[model samples]
Target: MKKLFNNYINTFKGLSIEVWWLSLITFINRAGTMVIPFLTIYLNESLDFTFKEIGWIMPFWGLGSVVGTWLGGKLTDKIGYYKVMFTSLILTGVFFFLLQYVNTIIGFCTGIFLVMLVADTFRPAMFVALSAYSKPENKTRSVTLIRLAINLGFSAGPAIGGIIITSIGYFALFWIDGITCVLAAILLLQVLHPKKAKVLDTVKVENPVSVYKDKAFWVFFIAMFIFGFTFMQYFSTMPLYYKDARFLTEFEIGLLMGFNGFFIFLFEMPLTKWLENNVNSKIRLVTTGLFLIAISFIVLNFTNWIGILAIGILLMTIGEMIAFPFSNSFAIERGKKGNQGEYMAMYAISFSLANIFCHYFGMHMIDKYGFEFTWNAMTAFAFVGVFILLILLQILKREKAQQNL
Candidate 1:
């Protein structure tokens, strides 16, 4: 047991202080992420929204995310990561406070859009900051550390959110979420103090348009898009499935969701480190992860038994542990020094696009067909992502060979 604990501790030893601070910031921010997880439920039960109406409204958040990521990437390169990160954090907190007052459908939809527009900017900037702060060799571990923080906080958020929703109301959830965002921003303000002009001058100025021209990146983008679309069902449709189809309570739903974070918190860091030491191929890791995710959904089709649900969630969490951090590392590796923000922004956009597609299509399927269909569709989508990734690996190899020649 002592040796086991030491091995886990050793995984975190050499990372920079900035990486630790960033992880702390992520923990703070994600701990208060109460709104989005429960947004569908809030709309359904509190506001009396139909599934169709909820579906239409949900995609607006994704649309805003799309805009936010694009603008954040540009601003990060121009203004420096510190400023972008600070501003995004503060503004997003303010927007979360504003979201509480939106009562009608249009008002709530617009509020969701605006809140996400500001909130989502933090993602790309965070990635850029992570890349800037860490050495090349520590990059994947750095990303994994941040993800570990996120999962730790995520484990708390939904459990607390379930309590707040049950005990106080939805309004309290907003207030708590907003306060935490502000607190996170304040912490960030204290930590990140880059010399703006010098930093900007030092950064390489890549043609932003060139990112779109890279065939390898485009292939990566497509794979990320599909992976994100399938994965996002956990946030978009799975909660509703638990409540509506399985007749679980909000607290029960929260527990189920929290299990994802709990499992990731326990295993992701160790798994990532082990993979780094043993697995030479990022493509293989990602392909295996995607298959695990597909199988997770397929597990759900077999049984709604609580034990089976836990197994499915565990599988998905393992998939996430293997896939996402490596994917971010792969993107960072693909880009030149100056283009990290641009590349990460594009990667972030894939998730934003997935949010739109997942909610729109996933919800529509649930409304028209059923949860079984939704899970099966997600399984098929992940398989497609795997196929694309395999092709992308080959293309990258060919490009590398040609460069050598």
Candidate 2:
């Protein structure tokens, strides 16, 4: 056991302070997001908001995230990664704590939006820092490891939030989340402090309108947007469905989200490590994942049994673990060294778009057609995403080959 432990320690010796620090950032931020798994519940039950109201407020959160993505990327490229990351971390913590005072719907929505915006801005800077710190040989593995830390944090946070919410109410969850983020930010300030890189090029950034001219980038973005649109509903609409159906309690919902984190912790490393070099691995894994997501949601409508819901949740978790990392790594691999921040910024936009559309459309669809129809429609959307992603992968492959020639 002593020899094995020594080997484990030695294995990580090749990793830099920057990579380790970024992992800490991811873990801390993910812990804060645990409160989000229950935010819809809190708003509905504690603050007396309707699903439609939540949906309307949802786009503001996405808009905040978009601001984060843009600012983090641009600032990381201009000033430095550590500066942007550290600032965002502190801001995120402050806003999360502010949620405690928000009683009205407008205040609540504004609080959530600001918190997400600040929290999300750290992401592009974090990813760019990780990529900058890693050797080319280990880039993909480094990305996977960071994601592993995030999932591990997610696993712990939801379970902890569940207990806190049950014992002390929703305010306690926000407080703990805020405190953890501050602690993590302090750690970031102390260790893995990244020096500013000398700018070697001044490539003009394409405006949003001009950016759409890149067919490949658009293809990737659209694919991710569709995937996110279907998957993000789990955080909002699906929880309400399960609650209304009496298939889960507040704690149970937290437990279900925790289960996703758990399996990712247990399984994702070996799975990604095995799939890393193989051609089309991203496409295959994500395809399977989308299939599982579609199937799980479809299956949920027929059963009110907690056991069946648990099984469906497990399936969703499996799909998530496969697709999330694969898509991220795929985007990184396709990007140039100097432009990684830009690529990640664009990638982040996909999820924001997903949240906006999923919440906006899913809420309306649920109101008109009910949970069964909404989920079924989302399943179809997931399949369409799968098809789009695969086609894009094929196109990317051909483009690469042509460039090689």
Candidate 3:
């Protein structure tokens, strides 16, 4: 037990204090993410929204994320990460408070869009800051530590959110979420300095179009979109499945969803460290992760028993633990010195694009074909993503070899 405890401590040994502080900020911010997980329930049960109307409204949140990440990347380059991070956190909190007053579909949709736009700007800025704070050798572990914080908070959020939704109602979710965002911003203000936060010591601006011109990055972008779309079904469609198909309560659904976070928190950091030490190929690790994701969804076709569902969620969480941070690390390593924010932004946009695709198409599938078909389709998508990413990895290898020659 002492040996095990010491190994865990050794995994985090060499990182800077800034990295630790950033991880704390991530934890606090994500701990209050009670709104979105429960938003579907709120729309369906409270507002009497059909799945179709909810689908329409959800894409606006994705549209806002797209805009926010793009603009945030540009701002991170021009003005710097600190200002963008500070403004995003504080304003996002204010918007969450504003959302509590919106009752109509139009009003709710608009509010969601504005809130996400302000909130999601923090994503790319945070990635840029993480890269800035860590050494190259420690990059993957650094990002993993931040993800550890996020999953820890995520594990807490939905579990607590379930209780809040049951006892006090959805309005309380928003108020708590808003307050936490404000608190995270206040904490961030104390630690992050403008001079220290700049990703590049001497700024060399690159045109945003340069990312598009990199053929290998374009392939990577497509793979990210494919994988992201498949994974996002957890948010857009899975909750409805738990409620309608399995006949579970909202609290039960929250527990199942929270299980994903809990599983990752228990295993991800140590697993990532082990993989980094033992694995030689990032491509193999990512492909295996995607395949695991496909299998997780495919298994759902055979059973909806709670135990089976927990197993499936565990597989999917393992896939997420392996794939996501490595993908981010890959993008960051490939990026030019001054273009870190833009590279990370493009990666972030793949997730936003997935949000749009999944909610629009996923809800439609569930409404028409039912949950079984939806899971099968997602499984097929993951398989296709794996194939494409394999080819892209080969292309990247050849490109690197040629450059070396």
Candidate 4:
């Protein structure tokens, strides 16, 4: 048991202090992500909004993320990750407070859009900073470490948000969320100098290439969109499912969601380390992750058993653990040659685009058809991604062989 504990601890060794600081900042920011996860529930119960209306409002998060990440990417390359990240965090905190007053559908749509625009600008810049802070050899583990912080914060945010919602009301979540974002910005300010090499450096490509022109990345992007669309259902329609089907309270649902983050916190880093050492092909590893997530939804329909909910989350969490780190490594490596911000932004945008479509699609299907059909539709979509990504593995290999020649 001691040896096992030590082995797990070994996974995090040797990373630079700046990388640790970045993870801390991510943890704080992610921990305050209370509003988005519960926004669907709040819209339905408190404001009496229809699922379709809620769907319309939620896509703004994605729309904002798309624009935010793009702007962030450009700003990171031109200015620096430091300024962009710090400003986004502080501005996003202020926006969260403003979002509290937006009760109408249009108000929410605009509010969420504006909030996410500022909030998501941090995503690409954060990753670029991650790439800069980490050594190339330890990059995947470093990515996993950051993800662990994210999941850890994710674990805390919803569980605490649930308590606040149940004890007080949803209004308090905004204060907490906003305060934490500003605090994270302050923490970032404390940790590193503005012009530190890792924080501020942007390499110039001999002749920069357009991220849009990268055919291979576009293929991967499509698959990631499917992955995000399906994965996002956990926070969106899945909560509605728990409320309607399984009859869980807000606190219970938060615990369920928190379980995903907690699971990742405990297991993902060691798991990622093992996979990095053992796996020969990162693409194939991602394909397996995609399948696991697809299968997680099917598990829900497997029985009328309540325990299956836990099982489903477990499967989905495992899939997330497998897919995300290597994909981060792949994107960072690809962006290393030139135009890092664009590549990272494009990568983040795929999920942002998925965010746009997933809420609308999932809620529409659930409202019109049923959860079973909705689950099946998302499953089929992910299976398509699985097949497409396998083809991507072959494409990556061919591209490598040609480059070698």
Candidate 5:
């Protein structure tokens, strides 16, 4: 454990301004994300909104993420990360401040849409910043560090949000989130100062439409979309599953999620760097995570052992830590030089797509078919995804070997 801790420190021994600022900003944004777990409760209890109403309102988050991911990536390539991050932070804060006015379902949805649109934009700019500052060997470490900050924030933010909500009100949740966002924006503006680099002279001027025609990129798209399907299940369905089982209290749930965050903080950096060293092994881990996710649902359906369920959840978190960063790395590896934004944007689209499909189908499966059948169905999808990713990894390896030869 001590050796592992030292490895984590060594990963960031001499980080630059860009890396430090990006990690700090990400921590703030992720801490703000703590409001999410409580938001449903807030809507149902405090605001007197129904589940169906919240359901209708929630699409705004996915929709806004899609727009934010695309625009942030594009603008960063053209203008730069400084502008992109600053603009996203300011707009996100403004929308967060406006959450207080959302009385009707439509108004709430609109407000959320605006907030997500602004907030999600920061992602690509941050990724571009990481890729820019670090050498290829250490890029995974840098990305892992950013993820670590996010996890650390996630670990702390919810407990804090819960306390504030209990003492003050749900209104306090949004208020605190908004204030943190503004502070993050200000810090980002003040700290991040990248020395401008020369643009590629031979960069192609392909029409935006032409990017869609890249056959290889589309293969990546399909694989990642499968991963996204599983990803959204965590946020949308897991809470309901825990509720149905009657294993959760307000504070316990917060702690479980905080555990999730803590695991990411503990393991992501070392695991990511170790996996990057062995791409083939990393691909295998991705499949393992997916398989475990499916099995977790199967176990959840059959047993009432909360202890066992907790173990299953721990497995699922391991799978996530293995799979997600690799997917990001995979996308960057596949992009042609100078098209990082487009690739990153394309990578992000999978999450938006997953949010849509997972919510619709996952909810239906649980409502109509029962938990066992729904999870079994998701498991089948995971099997197919695993097969597809393996094929892609093989092709990537062969292509790389040929280039080296």
Candidate 6:
């Protein structure tokens, strides 16, 4: 047992102090992420909107995420990640507070878009910062550490959001969300003592190839889009399924969602460390992850028992543990080969598009057909992602073989 503990501890040894600080900042920001997870529930219950209406409203966030990340990519290349991160942190916090006042369908459409626009700009810049702070050898583990922080915060946010909704009301969720975002920004500025020359890469890569010209990256974009489509149902429609099919309360749903984060926190880094040493093929790793997600969704279709929920979440969590860090590291490596900001922006945009498609499609399927049908549909989606990744693996191997000559 002591030897096992030391092995786990060794996974974290090489990361720099700045990487740790970046993880801390992400934790602070994400811990306050109370609004998005429960947005579907709030719209359905509080506003008395139909599932269709909730679906319509939710896609605006994806639209915003797309627009925000695109602009952030441009800004990061021009200004530096340090400034982009700081500005996004501050404005995103303010937008969360402002989003509370919106009530009508139009208001929500506009408000959610704006809030997500500011919020998601943090993603590519954050990725760039992760690469800048850590050594080349430690990049994947650094990504995992940051992800661990995100899941840790995710674990806390939903549980706390559920309690807030029950104890005070939904309105209070906006306040806490807004406060924490701003607090994260302040802490970022006041607490993190950054050396400007190291973290800020203001210099441009001259004659860089356009990301649109990269065939491998476009293939990756497709895989990530489908992955996002299949995986994100955990946030959008799955909660409604829990409420409708299993007769769970808001608190119960939150606990189940929190379980995803807690599970990832406990095991993702160690798993990544093991994989990096043992697995040479990242695309293969991603394909395996997608297969797990397909099973996760299909398992739900087979069993109506509540225990199936745990089983589904477990499978999905492991899939995510495998997929996300590797995908992130892939993007970082791909970007370094050409224009980092451009490649990373497209990476973020794939998920933005997925966010739009996933929520609307999941809600529509559930509303029109049933949970069982939606689960099967999500399973099919996951399998499609797996197919794409397999093709991607073949393309990467061919490209590597040509490069060797």
Q: Which of the predicted structures, 2 or 5, would earn the higher TM-score when compared with the native?
A: 5
lDDT of 2 by residue, 70-166 (tens): 7777787677677888888888778878888888878877887788778887888777777667775566667777988877787777778888988
The top-ranked prediction according to lDDT is 4
> Between candidates 4 and 5, which one is better according to lDDT?
4
Query: Model 3: which ten-residue window has the lowest total lDDT?
Result: 196-205
- How would you encode candidate 5's per-residue C-alpha lDDT over 63-162 as one tens digit per residue? 9889888888788778876788888887777777789778888888888888887887888777766777656556556767787887778777887887
Per-residue accuracy of model 1 over 1-405 as CA lDDT, tens digit each: 999999989888778888888899999999998776799888899889998888678778878999999888878777867888899888988988888888788997899888888888888888888877887777889999998888788777887998998899999998999999999998887776674211211235554445777888888899889889888888868889888878889889878987887777777888888999999888779888889999989888886586887788888888988999899898877655346667778989998888777777887899999999889988998999999999988997898799899
* Model 5 residue pairs with clashes: none
User: How much does each candidate deviate from the true structure in C-alpha RMSD?
Assistant: 3.3, 4.6, 3.0, 2.8, 3.4, 2.9
TM-score of each: 0.88, 0.80, 0.88, 0.89, 0.87, 0.89
For candidate 3, give the lDDT of residue 316. 88
- Model 3, position 329, has a per-residue lDDT of 87
Q: Which stretches of candidate 2 lie over 4 Å from their true place?
A: 1-17, 33-58, 97-108, 159-176, 195-213, 240-257, 277-281, 298-311
TM-score quality measure for candidate 5: 0.87
Greater TM-score among 2 and 4 belongs to 4
Of 1 and 4, the candidate ranking higher by lDDT: 4
Total clashes in model 6, counting residue pairs 3 or more apart in sequence or in different chains: 0
**Candidate 6 collision pairs:** none
